[model samples]
Target chain A: MRIELAYFAWVRERMGTPGETVELPPAIADVAALLGWLAARDERGAATFADPHRIRAAIDGALAGPDAPLAGVREVALFPPVTGG
Target chain B: MIRVFVQAAPIDVGAEIDLHDAGGHGASASFIGRVRGDAGLTELFLEHHPAMTEAGLASLAHAAADRWKLGALTLIHRVGSMTPGETIVLVLASSRHRAEALAACEYLIDRLKTDVMLWKRESFADGRIAWVEEREDDRDRAARWE
Candidate 1:
């Protein structure tokens, strides 16, 4: 599957890009799996994906949990906890 | 009535208040959030998912309306670069009574703290830029509503 990823705030700074599209294998089933796959992909993702619990995910656009299924999502955003009011 | 606005410009309180349809309400309560100049904070850069942020707020406004029997509600949040004392967000609620209006306004702003997916990066006076952390207290506060 091909998924579009978006990074915001420190996640974007650490990843060095706001977003990218990547092809994934069938084994990557959820947001956590995607993070693990990203961490092993290369140096750019090493530190960013180091702590999966510290990051949040949004499937397509709405906020989702770490266990959120990614089967139909074309876009995923990873970022730190929101601090706005 | 529900009004949700997400923009990069500063919020105009007077204009926003004037724009609200206040026809059937006897009380209108508002909460304005402004950038803090304390702790050597110089600037704040806000980032949000365009479509999602608006949708998120609309849902929140709906929740507020349902909970408080709101006659009118307005929610606006600003993004991009902002300086200290600039308006960051505004929540206004109108009801037939002061208690409902005030409580709903509080609920809207309080709920926004944790539930809304908006991030902030701070630029300090010494040229240090840092992402603001989500406070446990905020989560605790949001949990109170649950």
Candidate 2:
């Protein structure tokens, strides 16, 4: 499946790009798996996902957990916790 | 009526209240968040999701309206780059009574800290730049409403 991946704040800075549309391997079925794949893809991803505990995500514009399924999701936004008021 | 805005433009507090006041409310409460020039900070940058940020604020507005007897509601958050003393966010809630208006205004601002898809980066005069981390206190505040 092909999906648009968005990175925010420092995540975007470390990723060296704001977002991208990438084709995913069929085995990557959840947010956690996708993170795993990305972390193994290259050095940048490795460093970004190194501390996944600090990472947060939104699947299709709604907040989602690590175990959230990406079956029919069009976009997945990854970032650190929000700090705004 | 509910108005939500996510823009890089400076927030005009007077104009926003004037428009919101047209609802003929008896009580109006608002919260304005400005970038503070703390520790020689020079600039503050706000980054947000193109679509989700507005949607999230709208959702919060509706939630407040649903929870209170609000006559009108407005929420605005600025994005991109901003300097010290620039308004970062404005939330207005008007109602028939002061109690409801106050509670709703507080609710919107508290939830905004944790619920919205916006991030803040602070740049110091000493050449240090860092993303503001989500505080435990903010989480605790948001959790109170739940």
Tens digits of per-residue lDDT, candidate 1, A28-57, equal 999999999999999989899999989999
Tell me the number of clashing residue pairs for each predicted model: 0, 0
Interface RMSD of 1: 1.0
Q: In model 2, which regions exceed 4 Å deviation?
A: none
Residue B67, candidate 1: Cα error in Å is 1.3
**Model 2 CAPRI quality:** high
Where's the lowest-lDDT run of ten residues in candidate 2 chain B?
A: B16-25
- Taking chain B only, the TM-score of every model is 0.97, 0.97
Error of 1 at A36 (Å): 0.7
lDDT of 2 by residue, B18-85 (tens): 87753678888889999999899999999999999999999999999999979999899999999999
Candidate 1 per-residue lDDT, tens place, B11-46, comes to 999999999887879999999999999989999999
What is the TM-score (0 to 1) of candidate 2?
Answer: 0.97
TM-score against native, each model: 0.97, 0.97
